[model samples]
Target: MIPSVLPTYNRADLTFVKGEGVWMTEADGRRFLDLGAGIAVNVLGHANPTLVSALTEQAQALWHVSNLYNIPQQQTLADALVAQSFADTVFFTNSGTEACELAVKMARKYWFDKGHPEKVDILGFEGSFHGRSSAGIAAAGGEKLTKGFGPLLPGFSHLTWGDIAAVNDAITDTTAAVIVEPVQGEGGIRPMEDDDLRELRHICEEAGVLLILDEVQCGVGRTGKLFAHEWAGITPDIMMVAKGIGGGFPLGAVLATQDAASGMTAGTHGSTYGGNPLACAVGNAVMNTVATPEFLSDVMRKSGLFRQKLEGLVASHPDVFEEVRGTGLMLGLKCKALNMDVVNAGYDAQVVTVPAADNVVRLLPPLNITDDEITQAVERLEQAAIQVAAQKD
Candidate 1:
């Protein structure tokens, strides 16, 4: 039976009726450990008690109120986010893409307010994914995403990551901002060099441009920190955060310094459901639960274990895997064969993974995934690799 809605994603046959912690239960009662974590949005795991209670409580009281009026839960979450990061002001949205759009607009408006509306070109790097919105696609600079989109959104330019000369050359008087993902997610879990990120900061500073980081996928403790750019040891003038922020709820934000956000004082931007009490309530819960010294240390320990285990698996099945790379639990397998083949084979074997631009297999298990679950996932993955390796050329 064909579905009514057009499907944008590759097909996956199995559907789970319910999920808890790191496992999902299928209609047939078969349970599979969910390593994908809904592409890392379920950081705290599905049906997280805290998140459930927060959303349930809020839903019963007030699910939504127009942004036209004050929202206390929104304010509380804003205060928590600002306190945890280098931001002084925050604007809420319903998803990561919305946050990305807002960040780019805010940066350009910043320069526009300074009487440089001519500084409209936004420099983004190749393979970086901000989101699917028109502005995000324009700012990402990936040919695959922009090819069919007619009359590409003007003022967004592309530069190669780590190409100092190329990046510097791309910046001009018309440049309003430079957006980069400290850790590229859909681009195959690539982590940008810290030095290069620092150089980008200096480049933006010298060019008098704002540094806008698209942390939509890699932010909110996905990379074992509140934000991936924290590893780069510098902050962006404007930053976008969404995934993992609401503990699987739809919540996104553009956080900026007071100076960078001044242009957005009032009527500049708005979202009716962006800062709903329900989403903000859960955002507050997620922040309080996940942002902690012990939680981060656990992430470090678990990440080390994953790397060691996956590397061992790769060595054992050298024909199937090339290498395992990425930060923390956001690891990827650079495949020796087609990535989709491995992903499909894993699915057939009751395991799941995500495919990325560089033919990489990504595993974004919950941050609190236990060592036992890790061992099981690796075991299934090894079998899946063996099944793929045995295939004839």
Candidate 2:
């Protein structure tokens, strides 16, 4: 019995064999309502005809080509992103962490090109998660990911989330950029207040610092907007995006304004498989589908439904759930006990979900999920809440 080799995550009693829309079929052939949707990667839902066709078509056409030459689809997607945001240029990566790394490099190199090579520090928040890469871990400034990993990477500073005083004090003459999640995804879905972000933007502008928004978990229409920072009416010098960019495929991108990308001229940055044809084709599909006004409206509508249902759960089991928070389809339930218990209960009852920091259970269902599936998910969640309430003795 070859036991599982990886360190334990939240292990479930069942394995899913397939998924369609917001539902998954287990190995035993029983169906489960999937609220997590692979942690919100499938914005268009599972086995989407659009994504499948894109991947299959591109697979038959082109799969792997080094970044040594121009790739049409990659350029198209980059053009779309650049057209919609403040960015005038885009760089692709294989995953979110790579996008973060590239964003960090791009910001520092922008200053370095201006002859200020000393401005290379990346300031990340206390509860931020930026992936497992060495640079990403260093940028996150947290011990959970950095513990015992030899010496920590230099020029990475930590500031408490939403502490303007600390953030202002932390920005030195050499600070290259301040990176943050417009909404803290892994840090318990804590959204940065509008005033705070606005103030931060003004402060950064005044201090000549670059602001990088890590929209890995909250971008690509997750917040009923193209980017979460749109709510603050502030534009970032560099923005990292992933998760929903490819619908279900692995892809990421770093977008930078023309001035912000002044240092990233040819040969400065590259990724071999980052802008491969297959990933770019699928990314274009997702971008076209999710960038619609109606899709974003549905996200806003479902978010209201989710909040109402979660509020009911909080009311029903006041002893277990404290409150519900977040925007759009990306919401959280703060639990009285361990969030893992609610997550496990949801898993046992055939409703997949995600657990986050601060005892928060993340419910990141696909944006296109129907009202019927939303009802089922809420029912299963209510049952899980009741079970947790019964155990609170």
Candidate 3:
């Protein structure tokens, strides 16, 4: 029997009723430390007071005013993004997948309008995740994401992750863009080295290919920068942003340079619910707090603290954990034990985690988590590792 809600997800039995800061309360009133941070969406934290006030204040004044009319809040958010990023323009969407869709169209349309429609291929890498939309899955080009979805969207090609040589070999006259995640979240928290990312940017530039960065998971201060690409000191021609940008609200945007976005004129793309007052209101609050030097410096300090602790955790539980992977708050534990077992153990220890590919358990706590909370999180993780180790024994 198909469940009432369509059982597409292997959901956990726990039913969370309320969220506060870095904790969520189950229906039975058990509170779990939220290290997953809603899969890196709740950047500031669950029910963040600033975001709450932003949303509620906007909800009271106005909620929906489609893009047919001027939306001041959306414009304000876009201006802020432009001021902070390398983009010259922005288009709003409701999710990262939507952003990916527009990114593909923008790349293809740029070429089409320039009288070279043959330049439509988007070069991607293995172990990458853009989203689940047709264009996104096709762009990712992974077997797991594209098993039965074919005949899939065309003009997308895949290459080895971190292989600059493969990227060099793959670029042809027809290649329109090269898309990648600065920090791969679902591919097990793998971060491209700074030099490699710089090289990738150079390669794209030399080939005259637009660079599309999927910063949905690693952007907005998750990697101690507004976007992970900033760490490499290079910028993308087009960038897909979501997740942390909304501070738990559903909001996304595609940012592009003037040349890349030239083809997306008045009616090239839009969304009915994207960049609504409510979503942008919350997004503004998030950007105000996260895109600051003080806040980002704190995140960098906390990342160092967290990574040091995680390294010790892996050392202590040599049989349970292989190593710690990732940067800043977007950290992962590569497991020797089954990653699911470690996640299940975390549930028992009142700590929530997210499992990803490559036997990794992700720990994406809120950026504003306190020092004491960091210590507590590690203690709880240690408890979970002890449990997993015991089962092995």
Query: What ordering of candidates by TM-score runs from best to worst?
Result: 3, 1, 2
Q: Mind giving the per-residue lDDT tens digits that candidate 2 earns over 128-219?
A: 98877888889887777888895877889888888976777888989989898999988899999999999888878988999999999999
lDDT of each: 0.87, 0.88, 0.94
Candidate 3 Cα errors over 4 Å, as ranges: none
> Candidate 2, 6: how far from true, in Å?
3.8
Clashes of each: 0, 0, 0
lDDT of candidate 1? 0.87
Clashing pairs in 3: none
User: How much is 115 displaced in model 2, in angstroms?
Assistant: 0.8
Residues 1-393, model 1: lDDT tens digits? 667867776677887899899888888888877878888888899898989999999999998778988999999999988999999989999998999889978987888888888988888888888888899898886888888996878888787766756778888878888888888889999998889889888988898889998888888887888788888899999999888888789998999999889788678888989989999999989988889878887888899898999999999988889999999888999999888889988876777788998989999988888998899999989888988998934
Tens-digit lDDT track of model 3 for 52-72: 999999999998979999999
Ranking by lDDT: 3, 2, 1
Model 3, position 230: C-alpha lDDT score: 94
Off by over 4 Å in 2: 1-5, 8-10
* lDDT accuracy of residue 223 in candidate 3: 94
TM-scores, all models, native as reference? 0.97, 0.97, 0.99
